[model samples]
Target: MKLKQITEVRYITRDWDRSTVKRVVKKLTNGKFVRKNSGPNTFYYNVPDIEYALDNLNVQFGEPATKGHYRTSQGDAAYYIWVVSGWKFKLSAMDMKLEVWPSGDISDKHNHFRDRYDR
Candidate 1:
């Protein structure tokens, strides 16, 4: 994908400004989320790498450190951000249950909608 395409998609889905999108894209690039391929008149991004980086960043930064079910509007916003950032889950609302595990045991039993949602 190109930078313009990514910025446009994020703007539509997340209502982010172009500058904000550009900043985040820069961060992602610095974090090695996407590789830059500059051509004579165009630049392309590695889509798969970007997806992986988004997922990791969502998990590492979006997930609340606190435990338990989240039902507030703020929680919903965070959840939406996670989804927008490439979290692959099916949730209808922010009332979805969540679990937190400080330990390194992240299993299916600790699903995103369960008691082990955050790490």
Candidate 2:
């Protein structure tokens, strides 16, 4: 994907600033983690390489944590691993829930429920 698209996705998914995304992208390129492709209009980055770079970076540097009701990079990584392992997490008013299924589904329905129930 293009740098801008990747940056935007990272911003939305990980709450990373544009500068951080740019810096990470630069690091991936410099370190040869991602194969950069130049097109006529924009530069494209390899998706798997980006994922690998991010996973490695998260592991090496550790994800920053925050207080209540916010998603951190560590949380995102955990969720990613959970989904890949065919599991799902749900936080309820009374307890935290986890489910394992053959087909992993990651949706915002749980978030919606949590938001509505929390308040």
Candidate 3:
């Protein structure tokens, strides 16, 4: 599916604690919302399409996103800047705009959807 067409996707937030990561996975991959199987831990939720979307997005926008650091650095500095350069993106659902945050966290505020929707 096109990222722009995913207008009302679920926003799965974790519990903040370490176990929250697991909870967030459950929130995103629960069988109630996806396909069901016999054993609780035996099944897996597969979303190859999401991976495809991310790959396409990175290919389309990754170089442009890293150009800022490329132009600033001459030699060795460029190598250092490359460490975290893969975290940039142009979220199609979030207005098809460039977003550059230190952490790779995508919050509702970053998408400008705070006022329009519940977080």
Model 3, residue 23: what's the lDDT?
Answer: 39
- Write out the backbone clash pairs for model 2: none
Number of the top TM-score candidate: 1
Candidate 1 residue-wise lDDT at 48:
32
Every candidate's lDDT:
0.35, 0.33, 0.30
Clashes of each: 4, 0, 0
Compose the digit string of candidate 1's lDDT tens values, residues 1-119.
Answer: 33222433444643343344335544543332222443332222333343444454454355533323445657542232333332222212233222111232235653565655555
Better of 1 and 3 by lDDT: 1
Better by TM-score, candidate 3 or 2: 2
Distance from true location, Cα of 59 in model 2, Å: 2.7
Candidate 3 C-alpha lDDT tens digits along 23-98? 3333332212133432332222333333453444443333333322223233322211111221322222212122
Tell how far residue 112 is off in model 3, in angstroms.
Answer: 52
